[model samples]
Every structure is written in C-alpha cells, then in structure tokens.
Target: MAEFESPIVMPKLITFLSSLLQRAAESNDINQSHQSQKISVFHGLSRPSISIQSYLERIFKYASCSPSCYIVAYVYLDRFTQRQPALPINSFNVHRLLITSVMIAAKFMDDLYYNNACYAQVGGISTTEMNFLEVDFLFGLGFNLNVTPTTFYKYCSYLERGMMMLQPQINMSESSLYMGISSKLHLSFNEDESSQSHHQQQQLAV
Candidate 1:
C-alpha cells in the first residue's frame, strides 16, 4: 500500500486542489463565449452547488485511498492540462475532471478501489458518464498512468515547499489584521505584535 501523507500535507493538498477548481470556475465565468461553445460541444451543465473543498474532503473521508493517490491525481491533472491546453479546467468540466483523475489514480496506484458506479455516486454523477469520462480521459492521457517513486516524491517535495512559502504570507496577513485591531484599541504595536506573529507563524510552520 502507498503510504499516507503526513496530516499536515493532506490539508495542503486539499487547499491546492480547491484553489485550482475555483480558478477554473473563475476562468469559465470570465470567458463566456468560449464556455458556451465548449458546453454545447460537451453537453455541459451549470456548476454544481457543492464547494470543491467540501467535495474533496468527502472523497478523502469515504474513498479510503492513500494520500499517494491524491498526489498522483495531481500529476494527472497537470499532465492533462499540458496535453489539452485548449480544453482548460473550468466550472463546466472541473468536477468531472477531478473525479476522473482521482479514480484513475486510485486504480493505477492502489490494489483495490471501488468501481465506476461507486465513484460516480461519490462524485454525484451517473455511472454512464463516469465510464465515458474514464475512457475519454485515458485516451487523452495516452494511457500514461505509471508514476515512479522518485517522480512522486518530487511532486511531494514541491508541495511541501509551497506550503512553507504560503505560511509566512498567511502569518503576515493575520499579523497585519491584528495590528490594525490593536491600534484601534490603543495597544502598542512593534514588540508584542512581532512576538505574537512569530509564535503563530511557528505553529503553522509545523
């Protein structure tokens, strides 16, 4: 079995995936003309009600696949983007793409996984559509699903570094907010704020 990622990393993955889906939604909203044409061709529907973060957390809780599967799915998403730059991730298609990539990753990386129907239910789609997505996605990827450990860890390393980079920005943002509040309350700024911010940053860094 593939190893589960550290608890710290899983949330980072979740955040990253959710952001990608949101960006796709934003891109689709901004480019209405392209979206209409693409939707007509693919029979796409309006965006789903569920948030990407909630959907991913549901899959993580129920799918029972290792964190490695999610990592691989990330790789697949990247590869799909590279291979089909014209067909970018968007609101109309992001949900299907997310489901398809994770299912493929589970099948490729895990010994046992649920079938199309099960995954479809989890993804809130019909089995027929799931099957269609699986086949189409496989062809689009040229069936290159294999991922060596070295490549996998490289991705993990990149994600870890990204998490590290994100922490300071979050801390600074929060610190700035705290400072603004403290100033309104007639509290002193520099020393106390700096120490409190540093402490909070340390907690998140871990």
Candidate 2:
C-alpha cells in the first residue's frame, strides 16, 4: 500500500511549480536542446497550444486530486530529468509531460484518482496518447514514485528557494515601475508650479 501524505504543503509548492513550468514552457530551444540532446525523440513532438500556467491552473481548478498529488508530481519530474538527461522538460513536450506527471502522481499519491481516459479529457489529449505518455513517462523515471516525508520537505525547501529567487525579480520590476511613475509625477508637479508662477506674474502685471 502507498503511504498517505498530507496535502497542506502542496499549495505553496504548486505556486512555485506553476512559475517554473511557465518559464520552462516559454524558454527557447537552444538551452533545452543542449540539455536534452540525447532525447532525440522529443525534437519531433509538437508544442501544445495552451500556456503551461493556464493549463496547470485549469488542472488545479477541475482535478479531483489532492494538493499533495501536485507536489509528488513535481518530485517525479525532477527525478525523471535526473534519470533521463536527454528527455528534459522543454517547450515542445512540456504540456504532455505536465499532464502525464500529474496524472501518475495522482495515481500514486491518491488511491482514488480518475483513470487515464478521464485525465486524457482534462489534458486535451486522446486516451491512447495519454496511455502512451503515461507508459513512456513511467519508464523515463523508472517508476520512482515513493517520496518519504523528509524527501518531500526537502523538495519543498528547494522550491521555496526557487520562489525566493523569483520574488526578487518581480519586486525589482515593480520597483522600477514605481520609480517611473514617480518621475512622471514629479515632472507633472514641476509643470504645474511653472504654470502657477506664470499666472501669478500675469496677475501682478495686470
């Protein structure tokens, strides 16, 4: 029997994961190709139409699986990448990978998950494709699905670090925008003062 895990920690990890997947989906091929050069099969796959963020949010909104499912799915993804360097997550196949990883995770972590056909509908892929992807993904990871509590929290801490790194970039962008607005406001204030001075001069002359 699979170990029961808590879902409480999943939300924060999901947020971190959503950001990471979005960045990965939007990344160019140069770096990804270099990383997964050995996985030539991925090069032939077509990119999904939806953005990773939108797709993940859709899953979160509609999927019946608990939050821990996503956290476990993230672990599977990391392990898969480590085990299969050639098949690293890239834009071309990221959507399929996300769907497969989460579905497998749900099956492993939550005993009451929907089957591949149901997941297929959620993923916008056919049942056959879903099954194929599941098999391929499992083989890719060598079926390493069991995550201990300690390992789970360790993964959580890694994601927390990633979130911290990302937050600063966001803050910096917001700070720059605030400064731009401040500069514009200051210029507007200077113009207002100049206009008032001109009016005062006119009043004095009159």
Candidate 3:
C-alpha cells in the first residue's frame, strides 16, 4: 500500500460508491438483483441496522479521532462498489461491509489496537467470518488503504482565526456563522482539490 503523505484524493471513488449505496438501499425495497450478493453477508442475522449504528458509535468513541476515519471507511465502501459492479444492494451485508471498511481504515489511519477478532466481537460475527469478510473487502478495495483529508480541523481553526482577525467588529453569533460557512467552504475546496489531483494522476498514468 502506498503511504499517503498527503491526503487520499478519491472523490471519483466516493461519488461512485455513494451511488452504489443509494442503489443498494433502493434495491432492498424493490427488485432483487445480483448486486445483492455483495451484501448477502449482512443477511439472516440480528438487527443489522442497530448493529451498524452501534459499530459506528463505538468507532467514534474508541477511536477518539476526527470523523476522518469514518469518512475513510465510507470511501473504501464506495471504492469497492466501483470495482465490483455485481455487489449486492441490500441491508443484509451492509454492516459487514461497514465494519470491514472501518477496520481497514483504522489500520491505515492509526495504530492497530483492534484486530479481526475484536471487530468480530463488536460486529457480532465469528472470527472466521470476520477474516473471510476482511479478505473479501480487501480484494474488492484493491488493498489500498491510505486515506487522509487535507481539510483538517487545524485548517478550519486557522481560517476561523483569520476571519476573526479580519472582522473584529463581528458579533459572536455572526462570527460563529462565518466560521461555519468558512469551514464548509474549506471542505468543498479540499474536495475539489482532491478531484483535480485524481484527474491529473489518471491523465499522467495514461
């Protein structure tokens, strides 16, 4: 895996996967498709939705980091969809997919305190099952796990300070609003930069 010194530039991967997730969510209600196979690992189990939510909450609580880990996991899920068009669009395996993605993301973003067994315990899956799912997910994601965000909270803080300095007369409420808007705009700029970088890399590769 390439060590991403900069952040991961993968908006194409994110957009593609978001579409897949939407399609998967939709398919659960309507027609059944082969894309369902990719998600079948999530089926015939306990309360999958509740389980997924719990897993996410635990990740945030224990990871004690920015939502960057969550975002990276989501990007992994999305990237998987791009590679495997036959993935199932159902809730059956959504949690499994989410856990697998988070596991990979955690490993890449931070120290590996939690192993496959730990994830299995938290996600309510067997050790063997977790291992299998991890392998499957890794293969789908092309084993590329390095993902960081350029628009970190530090950047937001700097911009907020600049805003405050520039507009000293602004009241607290207005300053908060300005900070919020600036943060959002910064994130959008980061996304655009990542997209442009990816495009350039692709062009160079060709």
Per-candidate clash tally: 0, 0, 9
For each candidate in turn, the TM-score is 0.71, 0.67, 0.55
Clashing pairs in 1: none
Local distance difference test, each candidate: 0.63, 0.60, 0.50
Most lDDT-accurate candidate: 1
lDDT of 3 by residue, 108-191 (tens): 665434788888877767999889888888887687554334433333233334344544464333224223333222122334
Candidate 1 local lDDT, 26-53, one digit each (tens): 7656875654334422236677788878
Quote model 1's TM-score: 0.71
Sort the predicted structures by TM-score, highest score first: 1, 2, 3
The segments of candidate 2 whose C-alpha lies over 4 angstroms from its true place after superposition are 1-13, 25-28, 32-45, 161-206
Full candidate order by lDDT, most accurate first:
1, 2, 3
